[model samples]
Target: MTDRKLLLRVTLGWFLLLILAYLNHFQNGFHFDDSHTITYNTAIRNIKNVPAFFSDPTMFSANPQHHHLRPWVTTTLAVDYWLGGGLYPFFFHLSTFLVHIGLCLLLFSVYKEITGNALQHRWAPWIALFAAGVFGMHTAVAETINYVISRSDVWSTFFIVLSLFLFIRFPAKRKYGLYILAAVAGVFAKETVPVLLVLLFFYILFFEKNLSVAQLFTARHFKTVLGVVGRLLPLLLAVAIVQIYTLTRVNTETQDAGLSNPLISYWLTQTYVWFRYFITFFWPFHLSADTDLKVISDVSNWRIIVGVLFVMALLVSIVKTSARKETRPISFGLIWFAASLLPTSLLPFSEVMNDHRMYFAFTGLALAIVYAAGLLVIRRESSVVAHPSYKKAIIFAMALIIGLHAFGVHQRNKVWFTEETLWKDVTEKSPENGRGWMNYGLSLMSRGDYVSALKMFEKANTLLTDYSFLNINMAIANAGLKRNEEAVANFARAIMLAPNDYNSYAYYARYLVEQQKFAPAKEMAEKALSLNKNDIISLESAMAAYQGLQQWDKLKQTASYTLSIDPENTKAANYLAAAHQQKATVALPSSGLKTSEDYINLSLVLYNAGAYEDCIAACRNALALKPDNADAYNNICAAYNMLKQWDKAKEACKKALELNPNHANAPANLKWAENERL
Candidate 1:
């Protein structure tokens, strides 16, 4: 085949593989944080207040609410809003799919450069294509691609691969600019890519050395070196600055950094994650969100032994191949795999093993596999080191591994259909996992079966004690059952357990407002607002408290600000209009010909507050809003009789009974009105 035709064929095939992957994940809706972080999340969907998402991560309406400082992720979601309105996951998935295809093509080009010979020319492109295709659809990537909010990881892969492709283009100097740009972009993708950057620098310094200050900056000449630091120094400085920022934003949340067992314990668990990736690399399985790693409480655990054996095997292969004069790309691949995984492999981070974290790291292993295969194919072309039987055996092994892995990926992708199914499957498979219990609680809660939801939370609390989240939510269930005292105690306990949990504080403050503890209710709102500057719930609560206190102007501003964060908030808009009229100190209309329903709602609020005239005026407004609303007329009649407008009230009650003879309240109030009619 002509090289051009071959390239076209290869590219088309690469695209088809990604198309299959797209269909798989597209059939899957979002899992994990997709609801709160992207779709149902009010903070991310409103495009006009885009800067607010960037400026403040916690967008609970109150400025003091907790939010992760991940503006880069939000910016992409904001753009998604502009292109496609809220709740559409299709465009988001399509975008990531296209990027995945582009990444494959780039890997093909990089492999072509690394194998600069006639024999490797054809084999390298195909090998790289296989690697990219497998990685793209590798079922393990569902967490990063199928879960719409995980575009950050997909975005990072594009840049990292793009930078690598450019670094391999003719005359590496010209590609230096692209390299820096890609690195900067990847830095925002996640804290994971810098490990790749440092490893690449080591590779260029030792392996790809062309010898100049710029070349020197990229070189890895440990034994006989030239130009190394000046070109690298500038990029290193930029990376350093970003690192400091990430550290400030991420590091200070020390408690959140969470528990890391002994270094030995971590190292032992890491083996299971690594081995799991390898197994999935060959055969994808039940693929879950949170996976428990096999532990090594003692050196006796099988994971430690297996992991050491694998590491030693790779080390021996690299050293033995170096003595044979073969290029060290396989060694580079192993190191690349190992190095790219360092960030995720370290002490406690999220969990012991997340399959998605294997996305980029799989490439290193892919490279090792493909390169080893290429060596077998090109055995006739002068091997820097040769053994025909060994090459044939490696080829069979590679084919067998790929077939098994493809089956695995296909099976794993099926598990991502929906959250309820996913977590239900997890609970069945790993009943002891605390997170599984918590997630199942949410699924049950969404269905509104509160009793079952409470039971799930109770089980979850057993696994992770002292969790305010479970307590606060449990309070919601108690409230549903009308167990107010129990609800209040639980809410208070939640607040005490997590003082920073503004949600519990705002909700409880709402309960306090209902109880007429206006002063204490207002105090709690102020405290929550102080902690989370733009918390929407707290802002509304503060507005409610001020409304109770008759501080109209302050209530107006708080309600208006709250509505600005959430433009579709009808309740806030109504509150704002009410506050505006109240601040004007104008007499609320009591005798309006229409406005009955509004009057009814207002009357209800006023009657509870013991304001007779205001309640009377509210009924008048409701009747005006709907002249034939007999319920409003009846309410007005009751208010008027309370105010001793006896004749008018009696006449109003007659009008109410005329609408329906079964108007019980109308007859009772009408008798009272007639008793004192003047």
Candidate 2:
């Protein structure tokens, strides 16, 4: 086959393999950071807000603590929201997957250039393809791909690779500043793009200057070293300018700098994290969304010692390989891997290590490993000059490795299929992660498994006593189980912990609305809106409060505003219609319980407040006003069940059924009473 045709066929094959490997992940739900950055982030709900994303760093996340200046990330998320017409995971995943494919293709061009420069062999393009395939299909990359919001990592890495490709493939374009523009664009997606400077310097040192890694330090090559730095001056200046601009635009106060660990201990823990990253590149197993690894306080700890030894060995290998032209790519690749990790390692993050952190570093490891394997094949070919079958054997082995990685990617996609599956996997793999346990409890609570959810929340509270989000979730779980006092206490604790967070107020408002406490609910909802006016959850809570308080004008105004933000909101439309009709009706005082429906509503409020005796009294009043009222009988049965009067509960449920056989709550209440009686 002609060389161009061969490249086309190989490229097509690589694309096909990528699709097959990641097909299962396209529909995978958003996980972890997606909640703050995409789902709850009201800024991305409208496409017109995209411009503000560049000017306002707080638009990046609903949670103030997570705010950062990743305008490109936010812009892309907003576009995805517009394309999908809502928070659809598929479009978000597709965008990330497409960027990943672009990165892999760019890596092929980059790897081919580096490989050809190092080996001057006919198999350079094919070897580059193999390397790119290994990276594109690697199980480690799936951790980033399956996570929708981690698209920031994917896009930044793509631009970095594009800059490198342009620098190598089109030297004439350097004067036009194409590569510099690409690097600058990458900075908007992520702050780590400046690491590209280190990568380029080493590329020039090994490939352009033809110098060994040790020669740069020798006196003989001092001028050559200066020349290399001179060549990089323009790019370095551009990066510095872009970084300064980024710093000015970002909100420094709320940025999550990952300072959870003390500096010395965080640095110590990173040594072990490096070892784990290195091994996973080769083995790619036992990955977790959240890891249970803790910082090492002692320098003499066995894991830290092992980690230090691994780093020493890696440096030695890089230095040894840099001495030979044919092995320079290996040295360069190793340096790329190490440098890619520098940003995350030097700065402590909440997580000491994360699986998605491998996406960028593994790009370099893939090149090193594939090039090393190519060397072995060349040696074997020379020893057995006519052994054509050995070529097939190498192909088969590579194909098998890719196949296993593809299988692992598919399995990991399954783990990310739903909130419940994802958090369940986290709890299993990262059992000591209090956040993981709390997230799993949230998924359970979402599914109405409050009893099991509370158990998980209790475990999380033991581990993370002062976590505000955990306390909020504990409050919700307690409310689901009708533990009113505990729920109220937990809500108070959550608000105390995070007074500035709108989530605490919004959730508390929702719970108050459920309890018919419209006055407090409206106050809390307005407070939440003062913090984040675009929040739909808070808006809905305000609408509920207005409707309950018979404030037709306020209800109509709030619902219309909600509809403007979320045009497809059926609840808001219904509330607005209800407000229009109810405007002419006279509002009733809360103390005036003159009707059966009013007494039934009061009974529900009492039951939600855990006032079971009061609930029963209200239900009795409802029955007296409207004899044979099935709802009143059902309310009496529910209150009796809560009071553990099983016999009385069963009798009320039976009466409710006789009054109206189709009553919804009577059957469930009777079943519960019977089960508890047994």
Candidate 3:
């Protein structure tokens, strides 16, 4: 093939690999791990969420808590809600793929630009094509690119690349107005992309030496200033609108996972995480949804090594490149990678090594890799005259490395197909990864596979055994198997591990209620309650323990409090009503409440008790509350059937069908009622 065709062929090869990534992922639905991004994520499921999402930073908080709130990332999902309805995950993956490709293209452009003069543009396209393809298909990006929830990384990187590309070209054209506006557009997509400012500053200092960072920030001397401003006006408008919307509507409601340690603890933790990151980037075999990495509370022995190496890498890249001047761009790219990583490296973020953290930083690593390889190739070829054999060998070596990377990427993509597979694969690959085992255990527990989960937790305990959550999950698994003693043991162990907000106390206390050990259960439950009174699950368990112990007054108070916390929970309300009934002078709140749902559920709960009158009464209340409640209407028909009121049953059944023809219970009840009418 001609050189142009050859470059096209190579680009096609990389594109083919990208296709494989999508193909591997396409059949896989959004796993339960990332399910909230579509279903429960308040921000992304609807446009109504937009006003709330922008208003609450805590609502969109993407930290290690209830979830990494990703408002900007999930806002796209909200848009997807209208565009495709139930096919949100499908479109979500599609958008992510396009964004990934866009990012790859930008990375390629950067490499191609940096090395353009190296081979007179002959090698630029191939290098760019290879870099983009490699970055796109690399397994290291599976967490950020393939996993649905990690779209924060994808969203952030998309803007980062766009901003960087626009800024890079701005210098060559000296039309700052248009591209700077583009960079600002990027900042809206993710706060992380603003770090591009430092990257841009580095690129100019190391690569584009003619332009200073301050000069690029302001360019009044540009000939096309007015024209540039005009070209950029629309982008400027869009960014300003998003900013205004964010400021006006947004709240700091994005919840973060609480951290006990100070910021310095996070910084110290990054030493270990940074080392782990380097190891994983070079060897992308095992990955986890969560890794149980230990924090270095103190700067001690091994951490000193990690900390020193990190410092050396940063200083060397900065000093060595600036000294040579010729090697400055590579230095800039290296420093950019390290600098971009700093925010996550424990400076501000509590996370040590978020895969998304690598999104922009990895480009620097890739650039450094390509630049180093290019330099090595040129230096070696300078002394040796190339023969046919040498040219073939060079191509073969490049192909081998690329082929190996592709195989690894392909293998890694499979692990991301499900959470269990991902954690299992991570633990297997990263045997020393304590967090990997903990996550794998949790994934196993999710499926009710507690036996296997216990083993995984034990392994994690052996690794980062001091942590409390491992004990909590292990206790949960024990409770699932009805191993009460083991469950209690694990729960107590967890409480001892941290002495704070213990899930173990809650679990053991619930098991104690099941065993009729109310006294101990009440004591433990109260402690758990004191830690988090609003925890619905624990509150329900605690109230049950009180009810079983015949602490009627206490039960009434606790159950009422639980209902207040979660007004939608009929059980809590039911418990409170029962507690009130015990006092002969006070009548219980009607078993059914204002909700059609409450009436329907009350009817079901009473159906087995031969309480046909009460069931019918509850169904009537439900119908009265929600005239079109299909389930209530259907159940009313069922209640009538029990009472042998066939004509009334048939009539009520018809109303149910009219309201919800496809209602599961309605159809079954309708068939039964019709058979009776016949």
Best by TM-score: 2
User: Residues 1-678, candidate 3, lDDT per residue (tens digit)?
Assistant: 799888867777877767764567654456534643454333453355665554455344222134332456656766765466444456777777787877887778877776562345355566666656656766677667667656667777777776767666556654545555555555546546546656654555445444323333456524333444555455456556655654444433423334445677677667566666666656765465555454567666587568668767767655655555435445666766677777566444444456656666777767666666666666677443556677678778777766777676566667777678877877876677777888888888989898998899888889876887788888788889988788788877888886655356777677787778888888889887776555555677787777777787897788656644334455665666556554213232454254567667767755654556656766775776577788887878887888878888888888988998887776777677778778
Q: By summed lDDT, which 10 consecutive residues of candidate 3 come out lowest?
A: 61-70
TM-score of each: 0.73, 0.83, 0.65
**Clashes per prediction?**
43, 1, 22
Q: lDDT winner among the candidates?
A: 2
**What RMSD value applies to candidate 1?**
12.3
For model 1, the stretches where C-alpha displacement exceeds 4 angstroms are 1-7, 27-31, 39-70, 116-121, 205-226, 229-231, 249-255, 258-264, 294-297, 321-327, 377-414, 507-524, 541-551, 583-678
Q: For candidate 1, what is the TM-score?
A: 0.73
- Looking at model 3, residue 252 earns an lDDT score of 31
> What lDDT tens digits, residue by residue, belong to model 2 across residues 1-678?
897798788678768877988898878887788988988786787788878887788888877667788899999999998788677888999999889988998999999999999887777888898999999999989999998888888999999999999999997778988999999999999988989999999998899889999999999999999998999899999988877887787666656565777887888888889999989988877799988888889999999999889889999999999999999999999999999999989887778999999999999999998999888787677754677677677778888988899899989999989989988998998899999999999899999999999999999988898999898999999999999999999999999998888889999999999999999999999999887776778999999999999998898788767755554454665566567566423232234345678768766755765657756866776776699899998999998998999999999999999999998779999999999999
lDDT of 1 by residue, 593-630 (tens): 12345456656655544455655655654554466767
lDDT of each: 0.65, 0.86, 0.65
